[model samples]
Target: MSDSLCESVDSTNETPSKKTQLEDGSDSLSVIKKAVVVLTRLPEYKISALRPPTPQQFYSEDESHSSSDSDMEWEPEGDSGDSDFSVPDNKQKTGKPTQNDTTKTLPPQTSTNNDSVSEPAPIIISSAFAYCANEITKVRPNLPEEEVKVDMMVLARKRHMRWQRGKIVEIITREDGRLKYKVNFVEKGKSLVSGHHIAFDTTPKLEQLYVGARVVVNCQDETFRPAILAELPSRKNRLRFLVFLDDHIPVYVGLPFLHLVCRPLENVLDDVPDSPHKSFMSRYLRDWPNPHLTQYKAGYILNAELNGVQQRCEVQEVDSSLIHVVFKDNQHKEWIHRGSIRLEHMARFWELRRVQDVSD
Candidate 1:
């Protein structure tokens, strides 16, 4: 009985010791797990505390700097409070830099002076479809009816009839809901002051008029004034007029020159003389042709259209209305009517006059 009792006591003591050791081991394991978790979190906490917010974090700054102008000062005009400053959730996951993100810090901005402050809506200018294509009736003084109906058909049939290109200088709206425009015709050398409707033959592209474009200023006289397109000015109409090539001349730019500004001048010849017509003809013409062909020499140069192609030709033989000539390019002699051969001086005069008119 004594031996049995001693064994039972020893077993119970040993069991308690085993239980205490197990409990201690579990506590140590739990402590180690906690230490490992803390170590993982320490780097992230330190990095977040030390690093500054990236440019992508600020949506407003990113949007305003999209134009690459770091110094551009912009702010939400309204009082939206903290909403504008919030970073998007998707941006947090991606962490990629956007096109708008810039390194430069944005200055603190206040609200605009007025709540009404906002970007100006683009002005959509009307196209050629807006103008009236039909013929307009004009009143004549000292006439039987005091009114003349200029037929549109007759005007269309006439070759080289004046269809003056003009800009709407002023717009006036009538009580009848009809809009009238005051147009300044560059070719006509006059401004149509009253109820005249103007049309754009070719609409000017505002993007093309940006800096460093070669251009010409359309004038009423028989001279082409060349200029260079410069920085586009801030205008409500969005038309670029300010240029600095020759003397600062206000004139129309573009085909059928209308409006006041730089028009693109392509393929302008070098050393355009004081007299473009005289110089142009002097190069090809061995002898200038008189208006009446009855008084011209054999080797006269004539500007003629052969097979609908305008060319310089040398007169080989003159036979009344039929004159034999050879084209500068081709040696094959051909006969043309006297009317087909444009007189040298007359052709030059008209050519220079047209150049001044179109400013091309």
Candidate 2:
């Protein structure tokens, strides 16, 4: 009986092997059928050519120009073993570590002073700028030539939505320290009047300058034109100034001759009577954008007003040459140029001030 069972097992093994071979052959046939079916389905009709999308399809006229405006690249002097980061001019929020990157590069002993119980650095910021954070050095570099090193991140305490390159701006010194500078943006090209819409207490820092005043700026066409403000070597070096104009107005000036013109003033709103009073926003008008607005362009009308017998309204508008304004009455909206409008406060014109136009 045992011998008969052994013979049965051997015979069954052959049957299983045959079954496996048959299954593999069936799979091969199935693959061949699928391939044939796919090949037969190739398009019999001619296919139309598809055109590739161009930049004009998605980007607007303004967007294309702005994308190329800042050719200057920016890189942090972060090799000091410090982690530094920058946000786009869009004024977005990020991690605190990035805000304090400038502080991280200090020597161990200097950083220790931060942890030790001591008076906080009296950071004196102007209305236009504020103290963001600090960076501190942590680990000693692992090198055969043992040397002490550190890094730090001093950020803009005052943030702006339209902040761009080449605009002469200023940041105040929070304290007396190395690698820490106030925000002072230098406008190399044409002045930007759009910044007037940006509401702020002030636009630039106005402090008495002497030896060792810091001024950080981005260099033209560098790998990383990171925000850098270093101390002015001396009063002679204090020879740079940023000028902004309101309503496309221009000023012929430079840092070397700063005192000739008005220093940036703080924007502190005066008391407004509860009932109501005349305001620029209500009457503000714009014809075309400042650039397109030429010397004598007609502008749009805004707020309207009326007196007992006389009809009067504040009209706010603008064109290339000037911000067109009109004090309308019962008759019609009368035209007034931007220059005619009295300057409210210098704060609103921080980015608008520019050097006098050499171009006719």
Candidate 3:
């Protein structure tokens, strides 16, 4: 049998026809038995535990050391690299970083001394106006017959429902004893209006007046014109005083028509109770918009006089003297005089809207 197995092995190596010879069932069985006998005859083999390769096998000594060091020092992005791997007590409980931890981790370090850091100081504001103009309800007083006269500058309500500045051109007596005046508007031509539809261009004077006092004069266009009292009324001109308007225009205003702007004493304001109204009044008066400094530009929203009334309008175009605007109420486009546009009113309107939104 050994001799036969040797012959069969020699035949398998010497001839490729051995595969055809092994095609028979008995021959294939003998071939398997010969393979098992060959494996058994080899030196007894023992299997040992497998071991992973060392870095030195693939890399040089310097490279292996560097790779090992990098692995030891590597960390995920945003990691502070602190030795303590344990999460903070607050973070463990909340599962989110505390405000202090966030501040420290997010912002780049700018200073070495963290102990010197301090919070910003709070801002303090002082009150200015003694009275709240917004709280007051204005009533139009009935003008005496003598006060309404020809050539007098006044504000008259037109058919379009806006009060426009105009000068009385004629006074007409009606058969019913009532009176009406023909007014020549500064820009809107002329119109006939009754006494009740007219407002006098007059401001009540303060008890004590001095030169250089800040005052607001009622202009012909039914708007307040900020001015400085330049010259006091003299014996020669007791009725009128020379004042410099915000536009640098100097004019003589009647004594009864100079409105003084009263500013509360800082000490007095401190004595008053602290309230939102007082605070708002203080801030609003301090930052009041100056019409003289108003710069008109396209897309600007402002209160403009249109067809004898003030309307919220968006500026569409601007030029040297006229501003083209589309009224917000009716979307009517009109070209208005630049002097009749009030940017301060727009600011006040936005401020009120913001306050209302917050309240809601």
Alpha-carbon lDDT, every model:
0.33, 0.23, 0.43
The predicted structure with the larger lDDT, 1 or 2, is: 1
Better of 1 and 2 by TM-score: 1
lDDT of 2 by residue, 209-262 (tens): 211111222222321111111112211112233222221222222333222111
Pick by TM-score: which candidate is best?
A: 3
Predicted structure 1: clash tally? 1
Model 1 whole-model lDDT (C-alpha atoms) = 0.33
Clashing pairs in 1: 253-263
Candidate 2 all-Cα RMSD: 26.3
Model 1, residue 75: what's the lDDT? 39
Candidate ranking (lDDT, best to worst): 3, 1, 2
* Between candidates 2 and 3, the lDDT winner: 3
Candidate 1 Cα outliers beyond 4 Å, as residue runs: 1-201, 218-225, 234-240, 245-360
Output the TM-score of candidate 3. 0.22
List the candidates' TM-scores in order. 0.17, 0.16, 0.22
* Steric collisions counted per model: 1, 68, 2
- Candidate 3: list runs displaced more than 4 Å: 1-146, 204-360
Q: Pick the candidate with the highest lDDT.
A: 3
After superposing candidate 2 on the true structure, give the runs of residues whose Cα lies further than 4 Å from its correct spot: 1-60, 64-303, 306-360
